[model samples]
Target: MSEVPGPSKRFSTDNSSFSGAKKPRKTVLDSCTSDENDCSSEEAVYSQCNDGRMDGPFGEIPDHLLINTIETPSVSLLRSSAITPTVSEQSFILPSHIGVAGYSSISALPSFDDNNRQVAQNIDDQPSHEGATATWASTGSMKTLDFTKAQELLVPVPSDPLEAFLLFLNNDILDLIVRETNLNAERVLQQPGVTDKYRITNWKELTREECMTFLGLLLHTGTIRLNRLNDYWKTHWLFNIPSFRQYMSRNRFMLILRCLHFSSDPRDEDRLTEIRPIVDNFNTVMNNIYSPGKQLTLDESMVLWRGRLLFRQYIKNKRHKYGVKFYVLAEPEGIVLKFQIYGGAHEETSGQGHTQKIVLKLLEDNLDSGHSVYMDNFYNSYDLAVKLLDRQTYCTGTLRKNREGNPVDLSTVTLKKGEYKSVFLNNVHIGKWRDKRYVLYISTEHDNEMMEVTNKRGQVLLKPSAIVHYDNFMSGVDLQDQMLSYYPCERKTMRWYKKLFIHVLQMSVANAYYLYNKFSTKQRLNLYDFRLSILEKLLPKKTDQLKVLKVEHKLTKIENVKLREKKERRGIRTIKEIVRKECKGCKQIKKRVATLYECKGCDGSPGFCTQCFCNFHS
Candidate 1:
């Protein structure tokens, strides 16, 4: 193999001009002075052999290419490889390894043919390649830099509403629901019903589609009051035109009654364990279905349930004084991006305080730069603000007066009604104002400024931008709650977990409606109309109406006798038997007809002479 040159050889700058007549000289070489291992590499050295040939790892370097340099040999060799042919007149080889600045690879160099000498001369006249090697020499440290770390952040949006909606209610969840329903149905049928006539029997297992349609009907039906599913199934009243059985049979509906969770072990401590997969699976789907916008809000939403449960909560101020509480993060359009069920103190997260921890957990996947979050006083704190700010996120919310790290000046400052003041400190802005009451707000995004606002009476007033934006944006979760409550599928259930399942089901439907409006090609539909459409699709095909009977032709002799027998069983006399048909004869008056019955055979008819019948009988 040909040997590469060592470091001692040097090319003199005095002979700057290249001449074909002069024998090609050895490349310049400098000994490795530093202890760094970079200098010991093959490309680092150029030396002369006994035959006067320059050799190192690089066998034969041309003399015209050698530039006299007193600097490090290794860096110069790498920088030399980055040079490109100026005019593209001919082709030359460049090392596959080294890069040009941050560009991936070097372009092809010009070949040294007589036909390309003019092209090379023209290229040398141009200034584009000036100090190209020097630039690369200065950037030696950047060769190992990872370009992938600078990737742009991307958020996903769903193109199809139906597809996105069905993701949360996947086959796995439906299968589990079916299995649990069967288990409960078996248990229910084994026990007697409220009445002997109403005892359940031969309950069949529900198919996945049937169960889904049943849910759709429940959502579409609004509210109903009936003694049993059989009543809804069989009732033929005008008001119940499309009977509940049109969507799902009574037996199938009864199989899943009050049974969302199933456990093989009857004595399992956590009855909710069986249905926990649903919660996890649904949350995952919803999280990945659509990415939230830059603005988000965090607050608590209640799933109404007045039941005896270990995690059941009661908030006096809420419309529902008793229910399960869920901490939710939502977009301004009332879409729930993420949520966590509060299972008492045991549900505590690993972080600061409960409220701050909940806020952090809700905003975990949404901590991108410039993303703004709004919340109530329960979650706003200085520590949370700082932490979010560090992650390049901005947070704004109402702040409690007693919170730690609040500005002392904010607390001491007193203002009259309709007056406000604000202070900026450490990227956090604190605003204080008094209207009917004192309001304090903390934010990282807003400045201490007020904007003119027109009230309902058309009176103009000045409101702080922070307060205005907070009011407008902080209601995301509240808006979601309101939307959910409008066509709510919540039913009174003693089983807390079942109520939760129902709550999530309603949420999924509402979300689907929202997404449909967002992406649908047809006219947008409201929540009620959307649910009705889904119900229509899910319901069984309508059959032809049965023929009706006329009143006069409906009752024949046999039918009349049957009606009489039915009525007589309760001690009621029939009209046909009550009318007197014959009369018995009186004394002197000629042929007097008795108004009462004289004989059994003659009195059976409606018209008969009592005197004639009595005389004839005698």
Candidate 2:
């Protein structure tokens, strides 16, 4: 019910290549149609030449009938005529098969007259051992269509989804989090049992590379139980990486993770709202990159989340029935173009209904004349179809008979199996077909025509073209859901925002990888290979020197509080307990520096040389 906007300027077509070619002038074509020997004229129309016998018009035995309407400069006379015959004596004959039953074969069809015989030679010259075929036989090799050029002209190449993903988490966001966390450093360090000086307050702004490494670790390392952090630190290869340890510590990671701020204030309602920035940043990047084709599908998907939430949905049929609901618009290839997070009871709707509004919003920026949108019965209605038609967009969707504004006569029609009826009301084509169950469909594009479809059992059934196209294209969002589930990135999270974040991240990765395959000039990487590439980029292999270290040495160092304090730096006149306990400094000769100091200000006053203590403390 919203005012539909014009087609997106970002998705505007580049028709310069097509429009640049001037329309073929009629005069040029008229020049070729002369009256000499009609067979000698370029525009001579003829029927089948029966084994080199002229049966059709003008008594001219010219070659093939099919003509190249475009691209070819000259009209090709399939076969040349030795002599011109009178118009009254001319007769036309349809091509006939000599041997085969139902099949048409052009093989061994005779060539044209002597002057231009080779021009009309059949595509396949080998004699058919079966029935002699005709009518639909290939005349000659048709010029191949170059699909690469066509695709380039028609479809805009999608931007890398990975780049978009990283763009959303750019350096500005990292610096913002660091700046905010540093403001609350005192409170973080004052927490109970906070003994490590290098813990919470040592926050630093993360580089893009470091942030990438952090996300890589989060994605690569399955999940760690918070209670068993030390266990993972000791055994997990990812946690033991020297570079990772040097850049961040476990406690620091958690502290900063919790302290991340997208806005200036946590208590400000507008500032702390979590989903806003994420959704905006993601949608901005997604919309600017890929443009949807004329055919689009609208459907619902679930981001599986079992945690407590007000907007979580539980559909009886969905695989993950209980999760965050998303209304998605996608192309036939399952590339997501736009999406809306369902707010459940809080959603605003117009008189057209929630489903209708969802569709309109998804297509608000894509209301071009040639665009066709397909949906299931849930979002289909006579009024909705008319609305889309008014915007110069086409709509095709299955309908419910009992829905408001449906044609009463079509819905009431009694038809046996494999039967269908179609009727038009105000430019809306309504069709009712009986398959396993009777189905009603409304379309602005298709007529009531039926097409023969062969099932797996080889049974031919007539189905409406509307139904066939709906079945083919109405699964875009569902296909996207399936692809995302194949290598699911969802993990257990207590925060609903975190659950949503990970879901969006997974979507971004899948979309990026899908587009990469579609547009890449090099050998395309499959989903598995694409993911592997991301893993390698995020967490590169360790250096050989680090790889050779003992597992125990690689693990997080256990802090000996007593020995640590003993090595504390002394003031100018500070007193020290010079302990002879293994010298604590030298192994070769028991050389103990008198500079070992103990201070009451620190816990567990263990002795330490001034130099060792200074290096250890800070």
Candidate 3:
């Protein structure tokens, strides 16, 4: 797998704005003793207040929700006081409505103390809410996790890295880019102030080969970087990529980059119309190249573009906080299977929330194929997980403790650093384990069991089976982002669409590298080597020199033909069978030659062999 940042240091969940100052996450959370207030209806060690009152320890509750379920002791009560609570900006509201068969009014509720277990979250994470417990009502029956579909590569991958890369950005896409680039040039020339012919005279229509070479040069800059763009073509020994000049001149490269276009007839009202071709083509090839394995991850990738435009987002949880947000469905090992560009607030449809709609939309093709998806709190919900389960898909992810549809025992309960609470309902196993902080996990794939995971410091930590699986598969997109950062192809551009194209180009190259490593039986090259090889193929030095030599030879032959023709027009030159001197070129090698042609325009008009006749001409 590609290198990615450890979860311990990653940014927060995808979306959250701090209402107050953000505090540093503690490396080692303060440990706590076992809870003394351990009695609950579900029989876990959930802590209570200093006084005796049945209350929700994890989140705020509404009186109506509590008053309706007065007879239910486990309605919103903590299952254990020893379980640390998950920090959440969202407040958990108890769901309303329950049968009041045992009792009627709120006065019959049990009394508790004021001594409450330490809420693992700061007040900033979870807003304060207090009331009675709500009933842990059932939602639906748990269906069996029965998935038996097999995924195979529809097309064969070639051994060549360039070929593999082309699988994603094939010739059709390149041709499209070429056509649009030329179209863009025509469109620009048709505009005012273009007849000056300063940059226009040098502008020629783009070609597929040159277009790919432009991408190659873009990738090359990442490898041999300089402080400035013009440095690559400098004549000085200190700042010259000599081979770069062999493929394209600096002026030509910049001109192509300026005129680069992706689509025709773009719609201004449509946010993605300008770059729709690239996005659509890349997605199609991504799906056609290889079908993903059983385990997939759903997440967001932030392409850094701090420009002014609509739908530009600030995800505090992402390292690149301000940029275009992409909802990506990728494999566990950093293969982007599908992606959706966030257009604006309207990207999220009405009825369903933004997170649910995006997740479902990105996973449309892979749904019900027995793929197990892992996600963070940004997308994972009890309702979504149950919904995926109903579709024969499995999902496991860390949830906000207060997310709606959470089991009351798992959602409202507070536990110490080592305790946990788990309940299975509708095949969705919602488990809250206290390990430094509350880890609320909702899963349709894993059971309510424990698993061991090694931490960054090589220490063993016991986590739920779902949490372990989440840790294992949750970083597919992050892996892609991290690998991309090492040698990025992005440069500062005024056009936001240009930035998007460069970002997608980088993703395609990364995808190509993954396929190369996956299929090549030879000793696999690292990303740098793989990228360098692709660069060499796209802009080769060997053929450039040969082309130079061939052009020189052809130019000389044509120049002589023109000179001979000019002399004939003047009637100043004539070919005669004279006592021919041996050819100068052949005589040098001591080979005798009797030429039928004589040199022209020289004072002597010296007799020479056919090959040496042009050498003696004035």
Give the distance in Å from residue 227's predicted Cα in candidate 2 to where it truly belongs. 13
lDDT of the candidates, in the order given: 0.59, 0.56, 0.66
What are the per-residue Cα lDDT tens digits for candidate 1 across 1-618?
Answer: 234444443433454444555443333232333343223443433433334444233344444333334322233323321222243312222345632222212211223444323123232121222122112110111011111212121233334544545667778777877777777766766775444454355455677877777776666545454434455665334235445655566665654564445444453444356456666776787666665567778888888776577778888877787888888888778887788887765444733367777887777776754578888888886667767777778888898876655554566788999998776544667678898999999887877678888889999989888888888888877787787777655556436766677778778877777766775566787776776666666564555422221112111111121223335656866454333322323423355443433343322332335444444444
User: Which stretches of model 2 miss by more than 4 angstroms?
Assistant: 1-207, 221-249, 260-272, 346-352, 544-618
Q: Candidate 2's residue-wise lDDT over 1-618, tens digit each? A: 112122332123556523433322221112222333233322332211112233322232122322223322222222211111222211122235422211222222333344533344332223221211111111122111111111121234435435434544556555654455455555566778877575565656544565566666555443322333334344233344444454456665566555544434454424215655556566666666666567889888887788777768888788888988888888887877788787655445434267778888888877753678999888887667767776778889888765545544564579989887776644667778888889889788887778888888999878889888888898888888877776654456436665676667677777777667777665777776677677765667767645434322111122332322233555344343324322223322367554334432323344455554454343
- The lowest-lDDT stretch of 10 consecutive residues in candidate 2 is 129-138
Scored by lDDT, the top model is 3
RMSD of each: 24.9, 24.1, 16.3
lDDT of 3 by residue, 304-405 (tens): 888787889899989999999888888888988888888885433424466777878788888878888998988876657767776789888888765545
Assess candidate 3 and give its TM-score to the true structure: 0.67
Which 10 consecutive positions of candidate 1 have the poorest summed lDDT? 137-146
| TM agreement with the true structure for every prediction | 0.60, 0.58, 0.67
On TM-score, the leading prediction is 3
Error of 3 at 161 (Å): 0.6
